[model samples]
Target: MTAHVQQLHRVNNLCAGLEWVADCPNRLARKALLQLIGEEVGFVLEGVICASEQKIPGGRPPA
Candidate 1:
């Protein structure tokens, strides 16, 4: 598989795992989720905030 496809799979798996523990309030779990998504996809939600500051017109950030 291509690198992009593999990364997508990893992100999907992370989401599935999080769904299994939907009621937990553990900081570590949340942190891990963000880390996994970032590592696989190149940006977390927090990264989006930083990216918006760049002011790149017509740039749609990755999902």
Candidate 2:
């Protein structure tokens, strides 16, 4: 649980950094940073979606 919390904290920090970079004046740098942020956010969201899809196995098997 500690590790999970730490991971979420790191992701939050990442987003904060990405927000700061959004105003970068260098066009190429801005483009690269935005692309990286997009990929990382997508990866994190994919994991979250997969975790939420897990079943609790409450129902009995169908006959």
Candidate 3:
């Protein structure tokens, strides 16, 4: 779990650097940022399900 969070943080930092590159067009940067945001949201949701299943008895986590 710690490793996953660390990887996500690294990805976010890389995305930030890509967003600041002068050669990348505004539209392209926006698209990349949006994709990264989607990935981050998915990660958060997965973490939530994992935590919830551990806390609740007989709770089946989402696939």
Candidate 4:
């Protein structure tokens, strides 16, 4: 699989893990984990966006 697909899968797994951690008894740790997950997902999305933006309108990406 491509790196983009792998990153998406990783983000999906992180989301699922976040859902499981939502029930944790420790509020601080839970919040920290959630924040980390959010940041990770954000970084992945940013990368995707940057990659897309790198493509030009000539039916090909810049060299």
Using TM-score as the measure, the top candidate is 4
The residue-level lDDT of candidate 1 at 57 comes to 75
List, residue by residue over 1-63, the lDDT tens digit for candidate 4. Answer: 287778888888988998788998999999998898899999997776566657645444533
**TM-score for every candidate vs. truth?**
0.38, 0.65, 0.52, 0.78
Tell me the tens digit of each residue's lDDT in model 1 across 9-60: 6666767766655655887887776666556445443354445644567766
> Which scores better on TM-score, 2 or 4?
4
Residue 62 shift from truth in candidate 3, angstroms = 9.5
Q: Model 3 over residues 1-63: C-alpha lDDT tens digits?
A: 565566667656765765465455687776777777667767766775676676688887556
Worst 10 residues of 3 by lDDT: 15-24
Model 1, residue 26: distance off in Å is 5.8
lDDT of each: 0.58, 0.70, 0.66, 0.79
Q: Report how far residue 53 has shifted in candidate 2, in Å.
A: 1.2
Q: Which stretches of candidate 4 lie over 4 Å from their true place?
A: 56-63
Which regions in candidate 2 have their CA more than 4 angstroms from the true location? 1-7, 55-63
lDDT of model 2, residue 59: 38
**Model 4 whole-model lDDT (C-alpha atoms):** 0.79
Cα displacement (angstroms), candidate 4, residue 32, comes to 0.7
